[model samples]
Target: MTIALRRDEAGSGPIVERIEGGGFRTQEHYFADGVMLTPRRAETWAGTHDAAMLDRAAIGQLLAIWGEGLPEFIVLGTGSTQIFPSGALRRALESEGIGLEIMDSRAAARAWSVLRAEDREIAALLLPLA
Candidate 1:
């Protein structure tokens, strides 16, 4: 489904208006900027895409790079299933003052849209099913 703010609500910066595609797919469409991304082992921070996956090392690296504009929490979409991260990974994120929520892609998409609409500081790192 499409998620967009009203014309008047469109601020000066970029916003993830909507997300399309799910269910065992390797790619998803972001309607805001009209880009199709395949985050197989990657991360999408706000509108910035990266080639990182959900792993202990990757999570640590991401946390290191996260600066002042860090998200209050992150929504991790584990492909077609909800896969929780390892304890180490969870601790790492918590230590960095970031909350992590695990869910399937479909749920993640809906949650991300809702959080964005509420103007919350959030990011999504999704892994699409092969």
Candidate 2:
């Protein structure tokens, strides 16, 4: 299934034009399986297509993209439905001063659109909607 999201022709990273099967389509690229969007860039995130594998360690790997410059929060899209992460994971992010916002891919895409338009300094990890 293909879910059409906000088409931001003028925004930076995390601008999702649509979400196709097992991937997301931006204006400039189609990220297969998953994608990571940082304040400075957006790139394909391999092996994150499964939302069930989301864990504290998984988030740590994703945060590697930030290096030392972490975002205020991370918008995490859990496939086609909202799947809450473990409390430990939430607390872990909080301890690191990073908020974890979990949502379905659809809502995540919309939120990303709004946030990107506002130029919010945030990062995102979007799992495919398959």
Candidate 3:
């Protein structure tokens, strides 16, 4: 996806123009900003994609990183398959008033791009197939 970032007249954050690539391979994601992120060990956060940070400690890490910028919901892509997180993890996010949607990486990527285009507060956590 080629997301174009346009600067608002008031100079707000760059607006996403396009987003591409949902299929995961080789353990890398090429973002619209031209940054290539390779996540290893299932505990990495690339942009909005978090691999296997489902534990309490890892969840805390996410809270720290997002802080006040936490989105209304998060899309978690479990590699090439759809795997739901433990109930404990789900409850944790729910306790924070955040919704979680689990899907495959491709679906998550597509949803993330669409939500972003609509200016919705959302995040994506994707696990690569490699």
Candidate 4:
């Protein structure tokens, strides 16, 4: 397979470049802004196309990059698919004054690109689900 390199609406891809600020850059994919980690499936998780619920492991990775603690809003792209988060996780984050928005991988990639340009501390999680 061949890869292309160019400034795209989603990301730069084909060749993954680790952006200085955060996130992985490529021709068509821009993964998490801080570090691109391979997220493992949480136990007992019923996956959805529009709502891939985030488990503690994924959340931990997000928080680590979000060293500033809680961000104004967090955009989670549930893999290549877009799955909403489980209710418990949403409520938990809300209780901590964090805004969470679950979008599909594509939208999440776009969202991160837009947000990163302005917000220096804002972070995102983008993964591809099988």
Candidate 5:
């Protein structure tokens, strides 16, 4: 028996695929009337059980985009199945008058999508699964 491939238009928006072979290559694409907006390219990272491995640069990029907005809240994903925030990081954000929540990457992605769909420009730091 063979399983048939089904095409899903739902949530299929502009896709920016990052292919990693001998090296990494990024490609941007657009989807019409789909669930997402413009394409975005992101670099993939190795996942570790330790939250200390979180990439600050990636987090910074997301913050830079919504920094001017100075959202009341921000969400971050630590990758893998673990989600937690460093004390120093939290303190820094608080000092800047921004509240933050940390969760697994998967949850963060879903929450970001939901919040973004609401038309709110909430900043999200998501660690994509490799």
Candidate 6:
């Protein structure tokens, strides 16, 4: 299956326009694997896509998204399932004043589009759906 978003206007960040098996399509390019997205840029993530394998150090690196400007929150797209993170990881983000939101990759992609439309200060890690 494929999920798509309608682009009504231009924006700064790379919007998630389409999400399909094993990849995502943005206005800029197509990501064949997991991706990290910030309000400023999007890049390929070489880290583990399994949410169960994610740790504090893994998420902490997201702070480098825009080089010094941290996001207000983070969206963790855990592949095809909505795997919740450890309490320790959540607390760590809370201590840094960053909220953590977890969902399946497809949902996270759609959510990123909505939040970015409002110009919210956010970042996301989207694992491939298939």
Best by lDDT: 6
lDDT by residue (1-130, candidate 1, tens digit) is 4333332242222333333443222123233211222111223433222223345566544444444466688777665577776777777778878888888755675565566556666656655432
Q: Is candidate 3 or candidate 4 better by lDDT?
A: 3
Candidate 1: list runs displaced more than 4 Å.
1-53, 60-67
TM-score, per-candidate, Cα-based: 0.58, 0.86, 0.60, 0.58, 0.54, 0.91
- Listed per candidate, the RMSD to the true structure in angstroms reads 7.5, 2.0, 7.7, 8.5, 8.1, 1.5
Model 1 Cα shift for residue 27 (angstroms): 14
Number of the candidate with higher TM-score, 3 or 4: 3
**TM-score-better candidate, 3 vs 5:** 3
lDDT of 3 by residue, 12-118 (tens): 22222333453332223243212221111122454423444465455564455454556687777676578776788888888878888888765665565556556
Q: Residue 119 lDDT in model 4?
A: 36
lDDT of each: 0.49, 0.80, 0.51, 0.49, 0.45, 0.83
**Which regions of candidate 2 fall more than 4 Å away from where they truly are?**
8-10
| Candidate 4 local lDDT, 1-66, one digit each (tens) | 122223334322122333322334554455432223212111111223234446545576556644
Model 3 ranges with Cα > 4 A deviation? 1-53, 67-69
Q: How close is candidate 2 to the true structure, as a TM-score?
A: 0.86
In candidate 2, which residue pairs clash? none
Which candidate leads the pack in TM-score?
Answer: 6
What would the TM-score be for candidate 5 when compared with the true structure?
Answer: 0.54
* Better candidate number, 1 or 3, judged by lDDT: 3
Q: How far off is residue 27 in model 2, in Å?
A: 2.1
